[model samples]
Target: MKKYQPFLLTILLLALFPALAKSEVPIQKGERLNLSRCVETALRNHPVVQGARDTIRIGESRIGQAQANYYPQVNWQTDYTRINRSRTGNSTYSDYNSSVVLSQTLYDFGKTKTSVNIEKLTTDSFRQDLHRAETEIVYGVKSAYFSLLQAEKNRDVAVETVAQFQHHLTQAKGFFEVGTKPKFDVTKAEVDLSNAVLNRIRAENDLRIARVGLVNALGIPSAPEFSLDDSPLFQKEKIDLADALERAYRNRPDLQSIGKKVEAADESIKLARKGYYPYVTGSAGYGYSGEDFPLRDGWNVGALLNVPLFSGFQTRYAVEEAKASLDVLRANEASLRQTIRLEVEQALSNLREAQERTEATRVAVRQAEENAELANGRYDAGVGNPIEVTDALVSLSNARTAYIAALTDCRIAQAGLEKSIGKRD
Candidate 1:
């Protein structure tokens, strides 16, 4: 029974506080997280994405509030009052009143309809904002995922370099003991080995930092340590600049959101102008009023007309303010369109550059690897100097590093381009 007690307690806690369970680490140690999984986790858990979704809900609620004016409003009121007639007869009386009233808008010169339409448009805008948040989260996850991969590759390169230097050191010591290579060869190899070890340490630390970055991008800072599935970083995506620009213009969520805002602003201007017209409201009430029991009962119905009449130029200023706001939104929409074009062009340019670098570095790494092998072989044959061996190894390391960087850049550039074009998935 005691053995089951702890398990029962755990279940009880989880049932009582579901949020506590949600706060636990989302990923398990040694779990392999892929790019898609990371993006999904981010979209599901990121505070920004959650907040954006909440904003959409708020906008939806506002739409309901605006439409409420089209429906009848009911209210019930009860009050008791003690009146003193001292000025007339020094007499006091108690009065009680109770009433239930229903009021509905009869006409508002399209004001209610326009207001509801504006709210609907604004809600659509918020939906687009949510899409934008999702796109941004996806891009952040992709960029961080690629960065972690790059760091992992760089760390591997460092480890390999360290191993090669260790081998060289062993070869140098063997040659010196056999009276073939100078003590200088042994000393140089030792120094190079030490430097490679230092680089490996730095690389390991960088890999750790990259992992932290990836976890942050996942929006799960307390997630357990996990491995990532290696994605193809060198794959080139074929995209036309014209097509990308067109897609960005057509699909960018920020642009779409702003466009919706512009439409809403147009309606806002109309709503503001409606202040110059009269609005009609019809009301009906049933009530009982008396100072004692068995109170008299009565019912009444009436229609009220509200006119702006004279408002000290308040309506004029409201109309001007609305028009100015609309103008501002239009300007912003134009600026956002231009910004989208620039982003698409920049992403495309970066992707092209990274592709070119990847191809060039691929060749460089191959050549450097061959050169390192030849240099090591020649040294083993007592034909190559320690300087040549060291330079060849360094060149190989640099080439590998460059290749890793190019691949990472390619992946990040693709992510940026997708985000620029508002690729939600």
Candidate 2:
């Protein structure tokens, strides 16, 4: 039993090891988060970012492999054999052989050097890919952050509308009790209150959905119930289209990655062309051999010139393939540049439209608020009907919602513009 206890403990510890290693700090209930924190969290925790980092490591390893030819290779080998001499009365004998060899490349007409350069370029491309991943995550976080803020604002407006309707219903009931309003007014007010409650319910559900979106964007879906601090500010900034385009071309990681690939492809062509040249290698070996007792020892040194007379056009085809790949990469680079231009233009246009709408809706909300107040006052003074009050309140609610939407759009548009211009911050 005691022996089994140790085995069981070992098994238990092994089982728990994986869980402990993979455990992440849980988000506390009601934790407050802002946009910058969300972006940082996503960058640190997202699988896409981690995968990109792994890709860079792989490229770095490949660079080492390409550089390995610069160093000597050492190897040791051993062999034993038993021989039967049937003609000599079936006599048997054993033979043993061992050797240590050191080989190094003397020259390859810049083949190894070009390969190393290509690998370095490839690693640079992987680094750019990592940057691109982080940029995308940042943009996603920003978009989700703004969306959640919008949902919160809309929900607030819904709650306010419900409160206004409840007040109106109470006023209608009071007027009816005094015989100043008809029963129809009381019934209408009840119906409007019910609709407002329903809208509030829907708004609350939408807010929950927005919370889920933000959690997903943060790459922390297991996060507990948390609160976001609203911080949407609309500020106008001047942007030049030409300058934006230039920045995108200079800073976009995907474009830079492709450019590195193009350079690697050119180096590939050079490496393939070197296949037609001769390679010089030097090797030295020490060996021991014996049939019995002490063995005889010997050492040898030699140089080899391996010239490629022909290879069924393999070298020719490799060069051709490298050129074709280069052409494809160039075409892709051109296409990406065009797409970047369109993205920047569209982002700018959307931002302008959203800003204009925000201004318009801001004014509309103020007017609606004033109109609603006047209508409610008129009803209290017994000069306005229930319909006027309802209409004014509905208009006010809609104006507030529109203003929220416009503000959210402006924020999202600004994020889009930043992404298009390759601004990671």
Candidate 3:
């Protein structure tokens, strides 16, 4: 009976805590985030992207507020008062009034229209800003993805190097035991093997850090341990400088945002200049006023005109400020044009340099591998020294490292070029 009770308790516990029985690391089940998916995740989760999207909403709200000026305003009011006209006997009486008033702007010399246009342009500018943010996140994710891939490749190379050194160490010891190699050969091989182990450890640490960077880029703090799909190796892409510059000029969202701002500023200038003209408004009211209910009733309607004769130079200063603001935007547009040109030149140069480096290192990797293989064969055949093998191994390791670096650089530079040209999400 006691054994059955214990078994029943265990069953209850398992039923209550089923998740506790699951494996912690079961076959690496995690999402495989490709480049496009990574970019999508970043755009969805990144704070900057979210904030930019919120800015568009804010701009929309502003546009609504500006359009509100085009509509009529209405209000209700009631008042009660006691008055003595001459301080005589029975001279005080109660007066009651209630009214519903309506007011509408009949004309304002296009001020309301200009304001609405400015708000609309502002919203467009914010939209462009959002686009720019999305573009930036896309590039950021690509760069980080490439870096992680490079780290993984480097780690693999380190593992291979370690294994090769271990093989060389075993061979050296065997030769020493057979009296074919000296003790010095075995000692040198041991040192090289130890160095390779250290390098492997460093490479592994780098891979972990790279993974963290990729997660940060994805903006997923709690992302699972996932593998990335390897991007294709770099191929030389021929991009014309003139065409790239043109694309940047046409496609850059930041530039477009500034252009919208300039247009808004032009509207602001017109809005400010409207202060010089007269404003005319129409109003109407319907009311009942008496000491008691249903005593008297009447309605009134009228129009009012206001001229800005003197405002302490406010209009003058506002016009000056608007003109100055427009000038500033124009200057910024010019500066941005220069900046775009420089970015295009720099990206083109970097892409060209990376392409050249990758090609050179690709050949170097093949040659170094051959050299290392030859050295290993000679030593194994008792025709070479341990020093030759160690040197060749180191050369091969360095060559592989350079090749990986070049590949990463090329990929990162390509992403940079895409960003500089304002590739849309």
Candidate 2 lDDT by residue in tens digits, 133-182? 88898899888988888888899999999999999999999999999999
| Candidates, ranked, TM-score | 1, 2, 3
By the lDDT metric, which is better: model 2 or model 3? Answer: 2
lDDT of all predictions: 0.93, 0.91, 0.89
lDDT score for candidate 2 against the true structure: 0.91
The TM-scores of all predictions, comma-separated, are 0.93, 0.91, 0.89
Model 1 deviation from the true structure expressed as Cα RMSD, one decimal place = 3.6
Q: How many backbone clashes does candidate 3 have?
A: 0
* Model 1 CA deviation exceeding 4 Å by range: 1-25
Candidate 2 residue-pair clash tally: 0
The TM-score of predicted model 1 comes to: 0.93
What TM-score does candidate 2 get on C-alpha atoms? 0.91
Which residue pairs show collisions in model 1?
A: none
For model 1 the local lDDT of residue 47 reads: 92
The number of the candidate with the highest lDDT is: 1
- Residues 1-72 of candidate 1: C-alpha lDDT, one tens digit per residue: 999999999999989998777657677688888888888889988999999999989998998999899899
Error of 1 at 369 (Å): 1.0
